[model samples]
Target: MNKYIIYLIALVSGVLGVFAFSPFDYWGLAYVSLLGLIFVAKTSKKSTALFASFLWSMGFFCFGVNWLNVSIYQFGGASLGVSYFLVGLLSAYLALYPVLFTYLVQRFNVQSAVIFSVIWTFTEFLRGWLFTGFPWLQLGYTQIDSPFSGIAPIFGVTGLTFFTVWASASIFNGVAALFNGKNPKIALFNAVLLAGVGGLSAYAQRIDFVKPVQNEPLRVTLLQGNIEQNLKWDPDYLYSTLEIYQKLIAQHLGKSDLIILPESALPTLENALVPFFERLDRAGQAADTEIVIGTVYQDVHSDKLFNSMVSVGNPNFPYRLETLNRYSKRHLVPFGEYVPLETLLRPLNSVFNLPMSAFQSGAVAQPPFMAKARVFAPAICYEIIFGELVRQNLKNDTDYLLTISNDAWFGNSIGPWQHLQMARMRALELGKPLIRATNTGISVFIGAKGEILAQAPQFVETALTYDIAPMKGKTPYSVLGDMPLYGLSLLFLMLRGMMAFMRRRMNLSQKP
Candidate 1:
């Protein structure tokens, strides 16, 4: 292949990935990123491997996260140069993972089709966990629409990534063989792996792997204020925002058993929420309902603020703020919610220009919050993506899963949809209904099968009311956690290491 052609291939494949995974269509484009890796391996020079990897990553992040321009230029009020610099720096950092993977693969000389598959997948697993762990844009997500999605219930995303890369390498190698005017055996092997991924997915979809017993039916309502982030804190908008939510709740106050609002829907601290809490108590009493609203709660003792979801109105009586169900946001954005390296980077907040960039960390092992009639396991924003976090929250009495996010900052990009897609996977994995309420849009209710039961459109100010049965049964993923998947990965690493050691010994023995 020509030199420039390889670069073009990387760029094209990266763009395709952006399109496929974006909110517009199916997410199969993530698998296409592996193609860029192949291009680097086959055509790029060894010394230039890092450069090739960086270029491929640039293509992926630059296009995939184009929506960042909105937040930076429009929201953060940064200059074009600064915004572009930040995006470029982030892409360069993320690109290092793939570059490191490429370097290791080349060093190992484990080029067999099967070995290569494991090697690629192991790197992805590491990428997800290394450095605070940003598992965004995993190739397995693209296969969600394909038959390969069923494997998520069994091997998790890592296994699907393994098979996807295997299929990619097979097709790339097979195509290369045909171009070189040779036999197509390698291509056939690639086709078989691809077929197998699809076959398993189809089979898994048809089979009822999870048998969740409906313990009781719960009626709920999600309130989406569709309030603009800019004016949310303004005193002028406060009354209207509060009134809008109040009016929306009044409609469902008596009708539904429970009412839900988006993250920070109240936009007030615990002390500041006395009046509203009183009104909610009175309303719940009159209507005979339990209202769970996403509000900002501050711990008076620590004075550490939390993005929390609290429930009001219970059967136990007295209304001095029933401290029932609560979940604080575990994963905060690097610069958005809180600035990292506060001493060093604090100055950059002024230079780079950020909005409300300080937040306190929440306890990881906190107990699940109690609600009206059920116990709610809350995951604020990005916490939903962490599979282990959800699994750890599972308890014998845990009823439904709740995730509240302020996607208003992500704007109208693929960010919200990707979030919704990931949230859906968690529901599927645990065999529990997940209710996600967002500030801007994509507030949805997902069934145990990962199917969308009810949803509100993006960039809308509306309310959704639905009845989902709280489930008691656990899925394979919830019971085993990542133990099975991590164990298999460790086993692969040990076998690979042994094979390498034996090969080295044999080479030494054969020496003159």
Candidate 2:
């Protein structure tokens, strides 16, 4: 086969793999993508390693996250050319992670192929954590429907990602060695070892923690309120937006015990929502429901604005103004939510013309939302990806996980599916039933075992109603967190660096 053709096939295969594991299919495209990268990298000449890595990453991100075009064109009001350019730029930036990983792997002439793979994973693990973490495309999320998902409970998503990369790299190296007419015995043995470890992971998935002793189900009405992102900020659309959500709630008001809304469901400013709250409070009172709606609230004490989840009508306090069961969003998006290096980036903001160009960060240690007898752990949109953040917020008695997001930004891309995949990981790791409310679709109710019990289609303006039992059982991840994986990954990186240094020293000594 022509070398150019091999590289092209690898790129196409990687792109196809992304679609397979996406919402359209569950055949493990994520795993295939990682494997495809290794194959592509293997075909490259040593001189072209960096270029090959870049090409693989570009193919993976550009095709996998093409949904960014939706925001740039549909929401940001940019032209097709501009949207394409922006998407390409962002994907290229994401691609750098794989390039850096491949670069480091080549520098360390490690004897064990498995060890090399682990080092590759250690870089990926760091990419997901260091610098507020952009774990958008972690490999383990692809295993959501695979047998290996069971490993998540034992070792968070990072560990699973590390293991997947390690195994894939080992197999790739072993196969290449065989093709090159080298002694295939060592490679064959390592391949068998990888298979054995993978089988163990499959078996481990069957394990479950103790079930909740006394399960109390929470009847949740998740509202999608599929509002147009562009019109959401328009003052004229405020009443219509408020009416649409109010009407949706009216239909299921008495039917559900707790009603939920997507993030920033209130299209108005913080102060402007006071009147809307009065209406919601009255509706909750008349309909006999406790409501948790997403709104922007201004904290007078700190003079800061927050993306908050406010509660309306606690039945116990009939006459009292309903207090907020607020969860201020901790993980704010870089350009969309808050501009980093504000003075420098603020200029680019006007050029790109992003909506809500700035938002303040909320305290990480804020208390969980108090709803009826249950305390709900909340994560706003992007916050769901951080395993440590979720683990930290999980109180011993916190009954369930609640995430509110506006998928209008992601549009009809694999981005929503990727987001859903990551969220499911949280459900698996913590063994908690998750209630996800989104604007413009994917309003879902996920079981503790990471099963999507119920969900609404994307781009559909609808409310998804479901009842889930909030169980109190902690999975291994919930108990131990990512501490072990972090320590091990760090040690591996240090060891790789030390090995590289020793190899260079040995070469100098031998030459003398």
Candidate 3:
């Protein structure tokens, strides 16, 4: 096949993966996408395969995250061309991960499924970690609703990613070998391994890893303020935004044991909003309710500002100006939350001057919020997308996972749905029920099994109330967060190195 044609096919394969994720959820396309990349790596020259992989990932990211343009162009006061250029630039940079993976596979002539997955795991990990990380659109997220989701509790998302790649390679190698009337033994082994993973997943799904804390569920209300992104940070409209959420909280105060608010539900700095929060604290105390709400926190002691969430009421936990009863977001979005190289970039564009974009991260070891007799580990906005970060923050007694986001930035785009999907995966991985409250919109109560119990519609101002049971016990993933996968990956890496060295030796000796 022509190399350009191969690259196009590779690119199309990646584009297909977009439909496999959120709002579409055709999970099988992930396998198909990997198969196409595998074909490119196997059939094309090393250089061509590496470039083809880059094109493939380019197709995946450009279409998958195009919603970024909505925020950059519409909200950030940037021109359409600049928005497109920024998104394209980010997509192009991310595509490099797949290119490195292809280079390793082609250079080493890796055939073992384990070795292939090892390379894949490292590349994907590096992509998410290097330079504050952008772990969006990982392969494991597509399997959240699939039977393979069962693997999450054992090995987490990276494990599911390994299984996906392993199974795809098994299908490709086994079917091809069988058709060629060769390597029957290898084909049988691949077939059995593929079937084994499926069987294990189905079996694991039937077994309950955690149980509800009590027979009676906790009455929880998730508030979706549906505040417009443009007006959220406006000083003129801050009170209007606060009033909307205040009304929502008032309506649910006595009725629900816990009322959750979206990220930045109140757009003012925490220090500036003390009196307002004091009223909320007093109201919740009077009603015997606990409220978890997101806001911007600027410390009085320092110039530091944190994107934070705090709980009001439940005498044990009071609304405070400090980090007490608070979970400040750790994983801050690069340009969206805080501008990097501010001296160089801030003056160049309005995108860098986005309202409330200059914020610092909180401490890494902060305790989870205690609400309504259940412990909750919170992830604010972009934090939930990082599986390892979420895992690291989990505690032994964590009952429900909490993430509050403001997705209006990507208005009416698949971005919100995709964000919700990743949150579900976190719920699945930890074997814990989840409370996801979002601004404009997608407020949801996700079950411990990663099922959506209730959801508020997008762009709607609404509150969803449900009696969510707190879960007890730790998922294997909680006990061992991706360490097993990394161990296996390291072993595979050493094996591949030895194999490659032997192959070179054999080639040099046979040259005579």
Candidate 4:
């Protein structure tokens, strides 16, 4: 096959990955995309493989996260060209992960799907770890609806990633040989291997790693204000914003066990809003409702700001005005939460100087907040995407996964859909119900089994109410996280190297 044709196919394959994710959710495309990548990677030359990998990732991120330009241009005050450039630059930066994976695998002369998958998983971890981590649109996320998803409870998203690559490899090897009318034994072996893998994965879906702890259900309300991004940060619109949420909560007051507000729902510093929160506390206390409000908090001593979630009322932990029981956002976004290299970037454009863009991270190991005597693990905005962060916050009795976001920035794009899908996976992976409340809609109640109980429309001012049972058990993922996947990947690599070395030695000895 011609190399340029291969490159074109690689780019298209990457874009195909976009459909494999939320909204479109053609999950089988993920395997097809990987198959194209594996076919292109069957090259003897290193540059060809590396270039194809980069093109593959470029198509994936550019199309997958193009919604980013909406915020940069429409809200962040950047010019249209600049916004597109910025989005491309970010996509190009992410593309380096696949490029690096290709380089290493090619360098080591280990050109097999199993080896590539191992290296691929490690590079993904590096991408998420280095520079505050952006684990969005990862290949594993595409498999939430596929049979591969059953493996997530065992090893999280990375487990699905490993198998996606391996399965694609098996398909290519088996199908290609059959087409070429060559290597009957090899094709037959892979056919049987794929059958076993599929059978076991389907069986794994029946296993319940987590169990119910209580019979009683907790009534919950998620508030979506749908306030436009411009007015949300304006001090003039403060009372109006508060009133919108106040009315939403008032409707569900006595009928709910918990009420959740979107991230930064108040749009003001916590100190300045004490009287307002106090009023909310009184209402929640009277109604027997626990209100979890996303608000900004400032440290009086240092004047540093933090994005935080406070327990307002009706909780096992009593509400305090001065020092509220809260979960401050720990995983701050690189540009969204805080600008990197502020001096140079801030002067470049108005986009860099967005309101409350420089909030400090909260303390690590912050305990889960309580609502109606049930423990809830909290993740704010971008923090929900990191599986490790969510895993660490879980307690033995944590009953729910609570993630709050202000996704108005993405506007009416696929970004919110992808974000919501990930939130569902977190619930499925841990066997805990999820309460996701977001500004500009997508508020949802997700069951412990990863099923959506209810969801609000995008860009709509609304609320969702569900009587969700607080789950009590943990999934295997909850017990042991990505450590198993990491160990297994390295083990496979080492065994592959040993087997390859033995083969070469045996051939050399047999030479006459």
Top candidate, metric lDDT: 3
- Model 1, 1-512: lDDT tens digits are 56676667776776677665636555556556676777577556665655666677788877666666667766786787887888787777777777777777677654555566676666766766776777777776666566677877766666666767777777667777778877787677777777876887788777665555555677888888898877776667778988998899888888888888888887666568777787787778778788877776777778777777777776575356436356777777667777667778776645343654566777877876776667777788888877777778777677888888888876877788888878887887777789988888889999877889999987788998888887776666777866776677668778878988899999999999
lDDT of 2 by residue, 1-512 (tens): 46676567666765766665557655455556666776655555654666766777778778877888888777776788888998899878777778776666566444455565566666666677666767777777777677677788888787777677777777767777788888989688877887887788887777666365455667788888888887888889988988898889888888998899899998666566676677777878787788887877677776677777777766664422235457888888876777678887566635344766566888877766877668888898989989888888899987888898988887677788888888888998898888899998788999888899998988878888787888777887899987877677667767777988899999999994
RMSD of each: 2.6, 3.2, 2.0, 1.7
In order of TM-score, best first, we have: 4, 3, 1, 2
Superior candidate under lDDT, 1 versus 4: 4
Clashes of each: 6, 0, 0, 0
Candidates by lDDT, descending order:
3, 4, 2, 1
Q: How far out, in Å, is residue 492 in model 4?
A: 0.7
- The residue pairs in collision within model 2 are none
User: For model 3, what is the alpha-carbon lDDT of residue 362?
Assistant: 87
Residue pairs that clash (backbone atoms under 3 angstroms), model 3: none
Candidate 1 has an lDDT of: 0.74
Question: Which regions of candidate 4 are displaced past 4 Å?
Answer: 179-181, 315-318
lDDT of 2 at 448: 84
Q: Per-residue lDDT of 245-333 in model 3, one digit per residue for the tens?
A: 88889999899999998898888887888998889999999999988888888878896998988888777656678747788888889
Top of the candidates by TM-score: 4
lDDT minimum window of 10 residues, candidate 2: 316-325
Model 3, runs deviating above 4 Å: 179-181, 316-318, 496-512
lDDT of 1 at 80: 79
The residue-level lDDT of candidate 3 at 424 comes to: 92
Q: In candidate 1, which residue ranges exceed 4 Å CA deviation?
A: 176-187, 212-215, 317-324, 351-355, 500-512
